[model samples]
Target: MKSNTPRMPGRPKRQDQDMPVQETVLFTASRLFMELGYEAVSLQQIAKACGVTKASIYYYFDGKPQLFTASVSAVLERARTSTSQILVQPLPLRERLIKVSEAKLARSHGDFETILREARSSLSQKQLDEITSKEEMIHDCLAEHLIKAMDAGEIRRTDPLLTAHAFSAVLMLGIREIAKGTPADKLARDIVDLFWDGLSIR
Candidate 1:
């Protein structure tokens, strides 16, 4: 006995099937790791979340470490791409910096430092280096933009990489529990303003 209800109209239900299998696995792993951190989330969980069997996960990754490395590397690569795009815009250096900070602060990600610290023993040297390399690309991209800003007299000359690192540190500071209730934009502005005071031409 067929019911008289009509099926929902939208992109076909097979949209899930259309997602590349490896991509689905990596994305699921990334979210789980972000939400639960490395030690807690398991391959079984990721496989279940991806709607694939555990063997299917093993087919794509040798084990948890490989999958973790791939997921983190993918995250960092995407970050670098987005950071590069934002910094390349015509906005002023301070505005771009604020935009970058606001963009990152608005997004939810696990505490990367804590997660890496927790997972340090599990990650191989090569995998660690790969992750570090991917992370540095974002810093290096920001540094390049900063050097240009310095040369243009938008900010006074300073060590570009160190300044880039400092900005990131301030962002980290702004997101911690102490600043929990502050709006992302206000926090970003406060940080950039404090930063600009230091770098502004005397």
Candidate 2:
């Protein structure tokens, strides 16, 4: 005779005890969600990529909308942390901005804004707010650095927040046009130079 007991959602049946299963699921989902649009990516695909069952994902996330919000938040937080590090390094503003652009260009991802626009109706106000907050933090990080640059006479005085938005928008456009085999640094320099000419004191 076998015992019939319902399993708890908190403790998932571990396939690999050593692995951080929840983080793994989130990372895999983030990659798929960013590469493919919200509507295109299914929870099953994320679970398959993570080597876990579909039910395992549900244990961690309420549903696809919840998962999408969490996945995008994770991606934005990672980018924010990394970009913060790059901006804080003891480098010229030009070099720092170039490095930032290079970092953005290095990754292969779809236009997240386009994906968000398509998925807007599907996401809840709270979920959208959460994603928007993380994104604003990234922009704010860059804006802080730009403010320092403005004070130091590196770039002309302007709205740091607006400039931050402009730089990100330009990079988003660059991502689509960047040819394979084009050196990241070269493209980065071009972008920085284009802005430097416009933003610098003339």
- Which candidate wins on TM-score? 2
Model 1 C-alpha lDDT per residue in residues 1-202, reported as the tens digit of each score: 7657664442122344768888998988988887678999999899888887787788778899999999988988888888999999999998898899888877676677778888889999999999999988888998999989988888898999998888888877876732367788888889899989999899
Error of 2 at 195 (Å): 1.3
Candidate 1, 12: how far from true, in Å?
21
Overlapping backbone residue pairs in candidate 2 total 0
Query: Model 2 off-target regions past 4 Å?
Result: 1-6, 9-11, 179-182
User: In model 1, which runs have C-alpha deviations exceeding 4 angstroms?
Assistant: 1-16, 177-179
Clash pairs detected, candidate 2: none
Q: Backbone collision count in every prediction?
A: 0, 0
TM-score to true structure, per model: 0.88, 0.92
Local distance difference test, candidate 1:
0.84
Top-lDDT structure, candidate number: 2
The TM-score between candidate 1 and the true structure equals 0.88
